[model samples]
Each structure stands twice: as structure tokens, then as C-alpha cells.
Target: MSRTPNPTRTLASQTLFRGLDVVDAVADGCQSVQEIADRTGVAFSTTHRLASALVQARYLQFEPRRGYRLGTRLLELGFAAYRDSDIARSARQNIEQLAGETRDTVHLAMLDGDEIIYLDKIDAQRPIGVNSRIGGRKPVCCTGVGKALILDEGEASWRTRYQYDAERGNIHLPLETWLAGMHAYAQGGYAFDLEENAPGIRCVAVPIRDASGKTVAAVSVTGTTDSTDEARLRSLIPTVRGAAQAISAKLGGTLG
Candidate 1:
């Protein structure tokens, strides 16, 4: 059993928050202990100690000259959580059909903070397919799957998410431009990524809303620009949207 915290122990609990701060710093791209300390506003020695402890605990890993990165424990936990997600499980067959029909990679994704995580990916049998994985993350503001997942959010809230990302130092995407694109996508009931997330890939996506009418996830079909130009992507929108609806229904999600 965990012991009750005395005053000294209660004060010491700040270390737990500090350690988490360091972890967040690393997630935000701070690699070295000095960088983590600088970002977290903690002393260098304290940051190093906490980072060292995290490394020992397998929450972080060190490479001889490469500094620190997220460890295997995170991958284990992430996959465990993803594998247990009902949406991911329910959407697999629908995603497979989308891929098979389009002869392009299809994805099931869920919003994670200011990002979208690929919960499942069905690769096309053809030689050309997207280079994404089941557990990879991408910026939500620029990806079709991400925009579709957040389509219901108000413009202000959308900008707020961009702000959250900016605070974390991810400012590559411009807010005003993205908001304009998001507005069009939301109105259209489907989103498109035209070389936004990747230079040569195009995608069409629609939201997966639960029975309560809450957007719970998103589904997208991805293809190469060579094979899927704007005209092709526009044509495939209905197919992708239909696939999303099928998965939503399977998940007890709303069709409307």
C-alpha cells in the first residue's frame, strides 16, 4: 500500500511534477539535459538527475552521442492503448476495403492533443503506398485526417489548438491560412491534404462521430500525387466518406 504523505513527503512530491516537466520537454523536442532544463526552467543538475532516473526506469533512453529520446516503454504503452481502442478495432475492415477499392493506403486516426495518431493503417497492395505506421503521429492542423477529426471545433478553438502547438515550438504551419482551409473543409463535410502533410501525397478524409454526435475519430485514403491529383482526390472523397460512415456505424457512431 502507498503510505500517506507527511508534510516533508508532500513537499517532495514537487519532484514528480518536475520529472514530468522534463518528459514534456523531451516530447517537445528538447534532447539534451541542458535543453530540457532550459525548457522546463529547472536547474541543470536537477534536470539531469530526473532525466537519468527516467532513463533508468525506461521511460527515456540515451544514445551514446545522440542525447535522449522517448524509450521503448512509451512504444509499449502507446501500442497497448491503441490496440485496446474500440474505434481502431472496429474500423479495420472498413479501412481495408477503402484501401482495396482505392488501391491506395487508408488510415484510421484519432486526435491526440494538437496531433493526429494513426491508430491503424491498411497499405495498398501496389508498389506505391503511404509511409505511415499504426502508431505514428502528425500535426493535426495540416493533415486531412486531423482536420476531419476536429471539423466540428469552432474557428477560435482551432486557433487555440494551433496556439498550444506553437507554445510547444511547432510553428511551421500558419494559423490564418490553415483556418481558411479548415473552414472550407468543415463546410464540405470532408477534408483534403494536398501536399500539406507530405510533398507528394494527397488524401481525402471524413470524421467518425459516435452515436452521441461527437467526433471520435477520422478515416482517410491516401495516394501519391502522381496517381491521385486534385481531380482524383475530389472524385475519391465520396468513397472515403462512405468508408468513414461504415466504420462509424460499426462503432455505434452516428452517420449524420
Candidate 2:
């Protein structure tokens, strides 16, 4: 026997979907009830009711001047989700895949007091791979992963790190040139090491962000100059960035 659909259940499901649409519209910057209704194609009265319910549930907030905005409840949920995330474990599979694809060294690193510490490293099977290991620390001014870690920082911070590296004789480029390069890299959302970290070694790197869109770590792929020429290094940028983005997505983030 064919069964007819229940009217109450159908209405409830439609209401749930409409409520979610309202939330999406608000999140996308539809502040006023009429704006949300226009965006969601819901009637004005229904949109007002939905927004009021959402405000009562703490998913949205209303102010005198500002119509609607995301409430603190979403922030609390984001924090809780990030607190339970393990970045190293989350990044392992992606980095491993990157190494396997490129047949080169892969590194996952985080900034630590003006330096970057390697949280994970996948060494290439080749004999002449980079000599970095897990827990190794490197200067933050001359390495690809190091630059990626600071992409969101201001020029003042960049100068501070550059000066620190220069005092230690770790910097080879002039401050002006390095700063210019950093500006370009920051704008491009990636960085490169043109034999700056070690002679004959080159790398491409991208930042790994957290749920709140903070650059919490970095990922890089490195190879010798002979193996990774200019064209080859440029070709590896997308692959390295893909690995970093995968890690960021696992951490409840999205890459820009």
C-alpha cells in the first residue's frame, strides 16, 4: 500500500530549512529583517519571526542601530571546536601526501619566539634531501616556512625579524630587498626560499590557519636547486598550498 506524506512533518521540515536559510542570509550580511527576507525570498513577517527566534536562541543579536549580527554563541562554539583540534595529527596525512606526490622533503612548522619549530618533517628518500628533523628550530627570516608563518604580521614585525637575522649573520639580502619580497609574498599568501636557508636548497610554503582565521602554522616542500629549478619550484606552489589548505580545513578553517 502506498502511504501519503504527513502534512505536519512536511511543514516542520520546510520550516527548518527556511530557518537555516534565514541564518545564512544573516551571516552573509543581511542585517535588517527585510534584507534577510529579500535575500532568502521569505515573506517579511515570516523572516521577522525567524530572526526573532534566532535572537532568542542566542544565534543572532540585535542592537538599537545595528539591525542584526552574529552572536557570542557562535564564537563560543568555534573556540570549543578549535580547542579539541590537534593540528599535528590533522596535518600528518596531508603533508605525507604532499611528500609522496612531489618526492621531496615536506615540513610542518610553527612560530616560536622569533624562530620556527618543526612540528613534523617528511624526509625524501633521496640521498641529498634537507637535513631538518622534527623539533628542529630555524631562523624565521630566511626560510620559506618561516616567512609563511608571519605573512599576516605587519612590516614592523618583519623588520624586527630581519634585523635579528642580520645581527646573527643569517641574512644575505639587503633589508630593503628582503622587505619588498616579504610584502609581495604576504600579498600572494605564499613564500619562497631561493637558496637562502641552505646553499643549493629551495622551498615553497603556505600558511595553515585555524578556525578563527589565524595563521597558526605553515607547510613547505623543499628540494635541491638541481632538482627544483625556478620553473619547477613555481610549479610546486599549488601543491604545497593545497596541503596547507587541507590542514586548515581539518582545523575548521578556509583558505582565502
Which number leads on TM-score? Answer: 1
Model 1 CA deviation exceeding 4 Å by range: 1-13, 26-31, 63-66, 127-132, 159-181
Task: Report clash pairs, candidate 1.
Answer: none
Error of 1 at 150 (Å): 2.1
Candidates' RMSD to native: 4.3, 17.4
Model 1, residue 178: distance off in Å is 5.0
Q: lDDT tens string, model 1, 21-49? A: 98888887889999999999999998999
- Work out how many backbone clashes candidate 2 has: 0
Model 2 whole-model lDDT (C-alpha atoms): 0.90
Alpha-carbon shift of residue 174 in model 1 (angstroms): 8.0
TM-score on alpha carbons, each prediction = 0.80, 0.66
lDDT of each: 0.85, 0.90
